[model samples]
Target: MLDCFHDECGVAAVYGNPEAANHVYLALYAQQHRGQESAGIASCFPGDDFIIRKGQGLVSEIFDQSQLALLKGTIAVGHNRYSTSGKAILENAQPFVIQYRYGRLALAHNGNLVNSDELRAMLEHRGAIFRTTNDSEVLLHLIAHCNEPDFISVLRSVMSQVRGAFSIVLSDGERVYGLRDALGIRPLVLGELEEGFVMASETCALDLIGARFIREIAPGELLIIDGKGYESVQLLPKLPRTAHCIFEHIYFARPDSYLFGHWVHDVRKEMGRQLARESHIEADVVIPVPDSGIIATLGYSQESGIPFELGLIRNHYVGRTFIEPKQSIRHFGVKIKLNPVKSILDGKRVVVIDDSIVRGTTSRKIIKMIRDAGASEVHLRIASPPTICPCFYGVDTPTRSELIAHNHTVEQICTYVTADSLAYLSHEGMFNAAGGGGETFCSACFDGKYPVEFSGMDT
Candidate 1:
């Protein structure tokens, strides 16, 4: 079963590479964890018509050898989308391509725009026809309708209208561009490929294509790359305080990635160590909830001096949709997705480490499964603080009323999850271990301090 929190999106672009589309496919595959809803790629040689391919499926399911071969070009841009602002439909699949005065433009965006509703209404009033419900499309409209003298000027004008988290990659058939919001609420990095340059949502995408990590795109920086080379311009001024999404370290990003000026794996391990220090229980063995929880579990085991064990195994082949029989099946899907190791958990005082508890339903079900597998005592340790608020940036989360921690105390959550003891990493521990002060990162999901105010937007 997937966690309650949904990932934002992933983006990649390659310029000056003969196999630009192929490299982008590999990049999207590496970032499949970030999104599974839809995938797309657009490519073109300098002064050529763009070839665009998009589908409502996984990256592997959407593209194959023939499709990649047909996307012949030395420049490309790709996106893997998990929509937070739009309905799931073919119309909403990204790499949103359009023909305008500048010829062809394709854009893929990875964050939510808080003022998109107001902007959309304004645009519609001005006879702007809309295609998809996603806020990302608004960027394309803004760029197309700008009265600026040049492309850079157009970008600066558009950046002023949109407000919120955005890490976007776009192509105009000849060049590739990458940019992040002024507050830097998301991750975007540049990489050096042997034949070209790469920009993607994470360094892991670069690693998969054998590209060398260069550096993270600075907040408000816009990077433009073409056959000649690449250059950067600060289209938007840096705010007094930057707000990098902290969930990237806790659960959203791949552990192998380096994000927000720190190694994601190192930051996660530190969170686990800090959790161990905050809440310690006498237990026989420490077991992780599998995959996402494994790294932090190592740190917990190291600090707690408890032997680390892989008590839960996950099946990765599960898709977003599953057919149910006429009769409802109880615990069948959960078992198929994650199964506990009886040998490791039987007759032992087991401590289970997980990323975070959202609705508490999955955590409850998992705890029940562990007990059924013969664990005598189960203590649950969460790697991050309780999610008490909704994220307005990019994460798809339940409302505040739906979040268990919003209404219940720690003792109540423990009882609801049916755990002997439950503990979450403190907010201070998480921020400190992540190596930043409150001004450097966004903890809106934890503390409800939104860096970008909703009602304050220009109307």
Candidate 2:
């Protein structure tokens, strides 16, 4: 099957305790699936100085035992990133720490800034030299240039100008700061530990590090945790509505995470049930495209009264071929990643349930594999609607021209995937699967109705 763009960006931070850096590292490890392009950790030493180590690689590859041992501090922030706003490079890896008038700040940010290009231009005209191409650098520059006597006031001034989804964590030698956008387009939650307060993009990270779950950080909230104890300030009142990303329930988040007051795993399975009801496939066996689709496939199997089988086995040890560093090697990466369970599929009618189809290359390959495994008929059912448009907030989908759904009809997509039948969960179905009622969500990736405006300066 063809590959999809890797999930991008995860942030974790801790305030209090000398082992904060090590804790943040482990927290980021739990969120490694969210981003695999690069990893980094920055900590504020108790004496008000900082130590940072970041590089272009997975969390495990970049931070060895020795590296973690060296970073001793009381406050720290960590990040794992996939290049969404800029080309992949070590310089773009975060936590983006810089020396400023108010002292020094280390920042690890999740989500894209829709107005960053314009803000960056304004900063450049005023003589701000940028160190990285990613929009996160704009945050540090803004804070550095703010003339406000207090750092928090400067942070408020800077955050006010930033538009779009962002869940950011900053460390300024003593306290840890967590800020979320007014629209709340991305997920950010708070946790408590014996040593301090913890913040992460997902609850899975907190559970990984033995942190107790705390309430979610509200939209437009600025949280500060330090020796004086934890406190929150409403930088802006909660807007009349929230724009939480719809895809987080579909694919981005770890199943263990609790988001939007529901378990991610349960939500995905419900989406599959809804898709099954909408599609109503008749097949000898239902199969999932391993990993992401397992829960959905199970739900589909239950709803359709069809037996579920593991007809496709994934090689857990196959490091993502996307990181092979050579285009030629990457082209054949999927062959090593998945193997068809021939015995189970031989002479059977198969219905494959997947999360969604992006470019369609992967689904086509999967269908061909099932056919080759002797399946008499193959049907494809997607849990979410066709991703016809790219996501500007955080997801890394293709441009319109590259999206198979953007240019083709459902029947055409079926022919392309060589399936006996093809069906997708309707937009309304997805909304219902996520949760019922008239609650609003950001469906920009599915319907292209962005909740925020884009400046269109970055790829």
Candidate 3:
């Protein structure tokens, strides 16, 4: 089975813009890293004629010249998805658009609908025919089947019926609808472009098209944007609490993106410093696992008074090699992806800092290569706690039996990785570094305590 580091999905939408489809395409490209399995876009022209183009591939691959030419509209919604709750298939691809009494509606969604199984069963029992197993189809069914008079009323009715994390964007060729979860499990932000307004999963997507960050869409808020600007409605009254995903800061989000008023890079660097403080070791140089761990490794070096060195040189042009279809080509994949700088590693005591270890396949390969490069001693320091449990939210994590940390103690894990010494950041330390102040976080993957009930889940 593939490692479970699932993505929560990404959404992009724009209203009152002549080139709305192009803008949404750019936003989705900015969020391509979030979901690579499938991409789609649906647009509603001024005449209420809807155009939708969807396929099972990346945004660039699906939105080719012929498809883009067919999707003509001034209001649009797009989705890039990684299968978190359902099987990966073309039918499960997102931007589930359909015709309704209100007009042609194009819907793109992020996050999962926890109560979808029950809702789908109820809808199916009521004579609703299903087209796909994707949870996004549920929202479309509700919107199209709603007896409510206005579009917003139909949306409100649908929102009230669903439960769990959802950040949705919809358009009826005239207005764009933006909605958030009752608990805010995923991130959504609004931005203003010269032509009109935009909404996306992350701020980085907004920056792609010169959109100025307006603010984060609050939990339980439903926002509508058009030529006149935007309006907000409180769909579900705020609960007494919030449980945002902490892994977004630790590993998922882009380092340059900010979430919940916290800078992601700053949080990661702080975690590295915290890790260094607890796992201080006498090493000649501190090395990072290329791009993701660079900031944190720099923090560790700064805090520990150790020199930071680029002992490992990553192939900048190499796309993620692990996702290649052929397993036969994966054994020596790291060699093509990363190469050690022999001069820096030769006869040196090096401390390698990585974000987290999953199956330990990549770590083992890296350790062997470093040793082969003549490093006298190798110490592995991880910035996050061990991932002992699977993440059902969106991350594709291996089952408990597959995770090395789940079966091995720290010493055993160190020996397995062939590291001279190994240490992981304490869970509490990681939380503090991520700006936690005793607030509840979804640490299910690291601690086996899911914030929400999962007994009924297929996970």
Candidate 4:
């Protein structure tokens, strides 16, 4: 299996700015990797209802000058979505907007709620209608139906009933709000424009728009920004332990982004350094799988004193669909994305570095491709521990049965991938590399020790 890994969503919001919609556009553009299934933006002029433009495609494909022009506002919220709780269809594209009894509200969310299916069932029993399958829409429904005096009370009431990771940004036709889960499993950062504030899923989005890096939105904090200014209300108490998703550093986040108080690139480099310390070997050269593997490979090269080469070249321009030949070709799907550099790999004892190996079939194909390019031997080194559990906190991970390492040993995976040797970074080394990035970071995918309690979620 060619593994599929995706972080479900990213959110960006702006308040009290003349070009708020434009800022959100750039933020979503910078975070395009978070979700490619759909892109959307919601904007509203002061005292006006929201104007939302949403569709299925990359951010660039969905948004342009005319579309952005139509969304005129000083308050805006935007979303890039790869669904974990819903289908990947135009109907589920977000910043989900609705006109409720209280007022016009729009929401864009990152991360998943574990109890959403149950909540949807209960709400449906009570005659609540749902427009989309997205779990994020559940929060809006709860808030609208609550018998609360104010918005903060509604948040206080609903946030306790729902469980799991969520970093949300919403616009209420006037003010913008940012909310993070009690466990902080997903990241949300606050930034500053000259005239207003920006809330985004990562600091990289802030950087793209020349916004000053502020601080991460604290766990369980609800930040509200309005005409007078912004204020923080503790919607829920912080958990005894934080559950920041460790995979964000391992693969999901852009290398340039900073999450959980650590620079993602630097953390990945340290992960490679630690892996090298644990699994160094005699090799003529070290090569990476490309893209996500590049930074970690640099650290592996430095730590192991092995020369690093771009032995595998990636075709970044390849589209989601391309015409293939009528005749069948082996590994055609992988070959279209990555090709080996024979001159760099010929007669070499190569060490290949990657973030992680999911199903191992792709690694097998890659190793064979390297051998076809005349490599003498291929050794695989992973930057993190073997994944044995499925992620229920917004990451799109395979089922336990589908993960190669769930039941297979390191040696078994090595044989399956046709590598001369295989090794994985230790859990101790991973946390040590992060310099205690999170005292309670979630590593359920590696160890099967999920922080949040759930039923029938193992799959």
Candidate 5:
């Protein structure tokens, strides 16, 4: 799983819209790249009960015209999930709905809670019954068990008790609620639709439904959308510091989306510029590893004054069903996904750029493919710092032992990947390009300085 980092869940909610479910479906479809394991939507009518429909698959595969039509309501919340805290099972599919004294509540969460085990244990001691293994379920129990006078007070109390990253969207059959963690490890944005207001994990989702971009749901901020319009509450008065995940700019978010007020594509291009400044290579042509590497590769070419070429063509049709051969097949996995353009690579000194190298297996295969295509030289340049540590907030990463950078030195990694030469952007370079020298971003996977402590919650 570490060959490529998996994105966390994506959450979208719409309030005061006649076609709430339909709008949410379109938003989820736009953000489906964030998660593909499962999809779900929960809708609440003005005076009627909440309806739920969820299944394990892509958004399109799970919902049809009839299914979306059946989920009629004026308010809706939806989730696309990739498991980070629980197994890939139907039971773990999100937009978890529960009926309690407060009425039907539907919740969709986009991050991991480090204190989940401790919280679940405490809740269970007080006789809480759980139906799923997901950590997001802990929030439901916390909200349900609080003996506060109103829902907002109870939500405030629950927010204070939990720790680690969480960007949640929930509805209690009346209003839609959105909350971002104090550290802002995950992204949550607010948008405006003609029919109503909307909240989503990325702005691309907002664009899909022709929603006007509002500001992001700030860190430690709670957002409420209802017939009364948007309302704000400060959940956590102060956070130690901001720790916005820098990887969102590197790989996770769509290039067209905006993250932390910076255009994702622009940030990636700047990263490539920084990488080229730090490690410039003389070569015949520069090529990206396809899709994720395209923008960075363009920046590298522009900055290095080299011609850019599509030396490798990716087969966009490859899906999850492309299973690996049982027997040892040479580069079968990478082969199924990509192939080198012999015409472009033959007799060319190629410079290959990629966002990041995780396990190094895929990089090795790609280098070999270029070599086999008669490339005279392959100089590898990475757009970001070496990913030496695994991410724990939400992105699914391999263990430290599985990371190539953690186990091998740069020179050794270059040898392992069979590259003529290799260089990675420095931490300072990445910070300069993405954060503009601000220390508000989290580079835990590159620096191993986790913003949150997970000492007692490892189980």
Candidate 6:
């Protein structure tokens, strides 16, 4: 659903490609689905200073041929952002560039810092100036003020102090660095480019740039690329348990990407299969909500022995519908993005498959649209379990009071959406579909068992 929770950000970097900025731009474009609020690229040459260009817009809107031509370097880092911590402003865009004792550094971060307020206050008291309210700026101050003698030591010291999910990419005019938090609540992967090494939030970005897939950057791992190629360092002792965010498999990640060693598309399809087994209903046709639901809908149709049809068509050209006329129109917001296929739904009992439902408003509008198109019955099947709590790590989620699932039972939700029936995949079913036991992934949004304690922070 377009009204669903938003992902944090996407990070992309190249260590040795001469046209590093161009490659990073392509990678960010491929991972644009992760975040759309802002886009940026920071490049560094061997002897030259960091070249940075960032703005509050899409990659295509921010960078043109001339802009790319100006960013000359063999090392680059880029970010696509949807704010989870900082305000939506130009200064909050990444990769944030700074000059410290070590040298010029550019950093792009994905995920929220639970202790950012505490860290920021400490830094401020010590006379550290901040240019942006972004939690990412705290890292720069931490690294700059550390008493450690070397870059690697300073990074390790800084990582040990911060808490919460962080998958970061940093460059110091020549070398590129990648790091993941101890719990690995966010995703980051390493890839091999023809000219050098690449790192991104997802493998889809690497595929777009024709890079070979390398393994995921392990939890608490630090990867550095310089003249000596890539060097991996274990920054912290492996935690007893890791909190791999389960939502990545259910939503956030691109279907083409591999996350947690499983192809995202395969996991989603399995979730649909599991949903079919858990809740089987006889229907004339199975239809997906389009885009996000396409793979899962296919699995639902296959497992249930029902024919799958394109019952909804989405307008690819429409950017997010952020505005509506003061004079209300019937389902005006949804109508701008999606239209139902009358011939396919006419007089048929349709099973509608969707990834998840945040609030009942969007689902209700979609169901009503199907009904108006002449559908006899509308049965809603969600591939993932209901999201009952807000996520603090990275995802921008509605408060618990705003969540329909948190406030209403499944039967009540069915009534609220005016669907003939509604069913969501069970927590166990989701775990199985994701190819990991319950212990391996974080299901805090579904079960309210946060792996990391935010304490006084407002999530």
- Candidate 6's C-alpha runs over 4 A off are 321-327, 457-459
Estimate candidate 2's alpha-carbon lDDT, on a 0 to 1 scale: 0.85
Q: Which regions of candidate 5 deviate over 4 angstroms?
A: 323-328, 456-459
Model 2 scores worst on lDDT over the 10 consecutive residues at 322-331
TM-score of 2: 0.95
Clashing pairs in 1: none
Evaluate model 5: give its TM-score.
0.97
Across 1-459, the per-residue lDDT of candidate 5 in tens digits comes to 126899899999999999999999999999999999999999978757889999999999999999998999899999999999989999999899998987889999999998899999999999999999999999999999999999889988998998889999999888899999998989999999998999999999999999999999999999998898999999877676788999999999999999988999999999998888889977999999988899999999999998999888899888778667689788788888889999999999999999999999999999999999999999999998899898889888888888899979999999999999999999888887786443589898998888888864222
Model 6 Cα lDDT, one tens digit per residue, 270-366? 9989999999999999999988899999888889999999899999998754688899999898998899999999999999999999988999999
TM-score for every candidate vs. truth? 0.97, 0.95, 0.92, 0.98, 0.97, 0.98
Q: Give candidate 5's total backbone clashes.
A: 0
Q: Clash number for every model?
A: 0, 1, 8, 0, 0, 0
Better of 4 and 6 by TM-score: 4
Per-candidate local distance difference test: 0.91, 0.85, 0.82, 0.91, 0.91, 0.92
Error at 25, model 1, angstroms: 0.6
lDDT of 3 at 195: 81
lDDT of 4 by residue, 389-439 (tens): 899999888898999999999999999999999999999999988766345
Candidate 3: C-alpha RMSD to true structure equals 2.7
lDDT of 5 at 144: 92
Best by TM-score: 4
**Residue 52 in model 4: shift from native, Å?**
0.6
Poorly placed runs, candidate 1 (over 4 Å):
325-327, 456-459
Cα lDDT tens digits for candidate 1, 1-459: 255699889999999999999999999999998888999999989888889999988999999999999999998889999989989898999899899997789899999999999999999998899989999999998988898998989999999889989999998877889999999999999999999999999999999999999999999999999867889999898789999999999989999999999999999999989989999999999998887788899999999999999898898777677776767767776776898989999999999999888899988989999999899999999999888898889988888888899999999999999999999999899999999969999998888888899884221
> Residue 327 in model 2: shift from native, Å?
16
